[model samples]
Target: MALWGGLGQAATVAQLVGADVGGLISNIIQAAATARQNKKECEQLARRVLMIADLLPHLQDPEVMRRPEVRRPLTGIDDTLREAHELVTSCQGKSAAYQFVMAGRLADRFRDVQSRIDSYLLVFPFISHIDITRRLDRIYNILLSNDTAGPSSSAGSQLDVLVSQEVLVHRHGVGKFTLKELVVATNNFAQEIGRGSFGRVHKGVLPDGREVAVKSLGKASSQHGWQGLLRELDVVSCLRHKHIVHLVGCCVVRQKKSLLSFWRKNVEKQEELLLVYEYMKNGSLHDHLHGPSSSSSPSPVMASWKMRIEILLGVSRAIEYLHDYAGVIHRDIKLSNILVDSSWVPRLTDFGVVVNWDEA
Candidate 1:
């Protein structure tokens, strides 16, 4: 009764919904009752003990007392007896249906209680019900597989695992975008404005007539799960610079999909990573520097001596800001990665392969 009350009180403290708590408590009580019934059933299955002892000679050895084979069996027997005693002490106050059903099952696995108990204790509860269910399912699959498989796969790399967990727990306000919206914005990834080692970029026009450039990365299959994408997301989401091209928004499917991080930080409220940004009208400096028109003509629209100097100065300042203020390194510092806005204001774009050089 005391133990039952303690569980009931714990349920209350956990703030479980009345319906959920009611179900859990009922199940627990049912399980306890089933244990008592199993004890009674065991009395009738006297032949079961003989068969078990025959199959497990370890139970006969004097050292069996210290071995799991003997300890588990004895422990199960003790629990069964105790459960029966408790049911009788209740004077039939609670239903014994749970006990009877539970005992039938326990009797079937009478030799494996220690393993089951060890497994049950290792499962840590999660705040999300889905997480708990997933963990339990994982455990069941692992056990069912007889330990042949490796540990369950996570969404990110080991470091990324920590970041994802922290974000879910602490960064609750962050919104996730979908792949469809990105596809639509980027015109099915057809208008190739720029290309990089990681992916390609295209010019896009949002519904409100706002211009944006969307970078479509290569497909990520099972080879690059959440952690790989998550590491990229974590790094890109937090980047902020006046001259840096902003990440406006991104979207991805939970299980299998590409990730899109946006940069759209308002003047007053700045997000360290993840964004929606003001788009640049003109394409990257690469389009003007080594593009077909620039390479053939030797003088693109923005490649005049005067404009070239301004572009160089602008890019230099952008690099300095990222290096000094943000502690970031623009590794691929070629002309093509730089963009010119409507006012000819140059912005540094693409940090997909950037490095961190805080000291320098």
Candidate 2:
């Protein structure tokens, strides 16, 4: 088999190995297409194996493939694909009686291959963060295409919600919240927490009882404000890190209303954009340093030399991560933008003015 044939090869020749493995996976997929027994299971296995095949090209970098983390999963995928091929090929050209006798066993084999492929793919390290972001954008586009196909059924809506929650929250580290949902969470925007160039922040509680800070875009009507909102979303959605402020999700509300006037007046449509973030209960580093909290009876926690050092280190690491791993440059890094969580861990925020290093 191709799997065993490629073993014991030099790590530096990973590109060649990846190509060979990909070709084997293609053959397996082709074999699965002709499967008579366990047709559904065979198709499922093919789909899972294809996902691995899609990732193989990205692993062609010799240095990346040499890493144990990457190499082990690639090897596991190879072995699983080999077994999958054998399982699928066995089901082809089988007599009905033979298929019936071995149906359960074949089904188990397919399930095992599917499970192994999924586990291996789960551990596959993303070689490029930009590529990951692009993939996520493609997923979001697919969702949008489905939504615009036609009027949605309840079942379809439920599926879309499930997909959005799973793919957006778990994979992309973000969520999509509706305006009505935000209204209920924020008590109709009753509590004002802070303000920024883009919008006003309101304190809110999510349906799951988690506190959040909702920034309602004040400049949605202006071209500059609209661009800022898009820029912030573009930059923040792709970032996932410990010391970075987690973007819970965003809400975009569009409404059409007619303007009745003596002069020429038509329907006006506007989008209300809001970004939700994890609530920083301890507030900003600026608040602790120069605000009322830093007065005569200052917060002892912020006053601690060790705590301050840790906070500084956390903020520095966040900046370093942005520059190195994410290829981002946060142009507006100020004390006020450095939020502190309940544990006093500093989180870097306000990416509205951030730029890609390439662009910078």
- Per-residue lDDT for 295 in model 1? 48
Best by lDDT: 2
What's the count of clashing pairs in each model shown? 29, 0
- TM-score for each candidate, following the candidate numbering: 0.43, 0.55
TM-score between candidate 2 and the true structure: 0.55
Candidate 2: regions farther than 4 A off: 1-173, 219-221, 255-270, 293-297
Candidate 2 residue-wise lDDT, 1-360, digit = tens:
333233323233335345356556778879988887778888888777666655555554565456665555456455667788888888888899999898788777777877778787776555444345555565555545654574345645454455444444555566788888999999999999887667788999998999999987774356456556656866788888999999888875533211111012221334466889999998988888877643567775556999989988999999999999999899988899999998888998887777888898
Which 10 successive residues of model 2 have the least lDDT summed? 256-265
How do the residues 289-358 of candidate 1 rate in per-residue lDDT, one tens digit apiece? 6666634556444447888888788888888887777677767777777888887778887665665685
lDDT of 2: 0.70
Off by over 4 Å in 1: 1-175, 220-232, 256-278, 293-304, 358-360
Error of 1 at 63 (Å): 49
Q: In order, what is each prediction's RMSD in angstroms?
A: 20.7, 13.7
Best by TM-score: 2
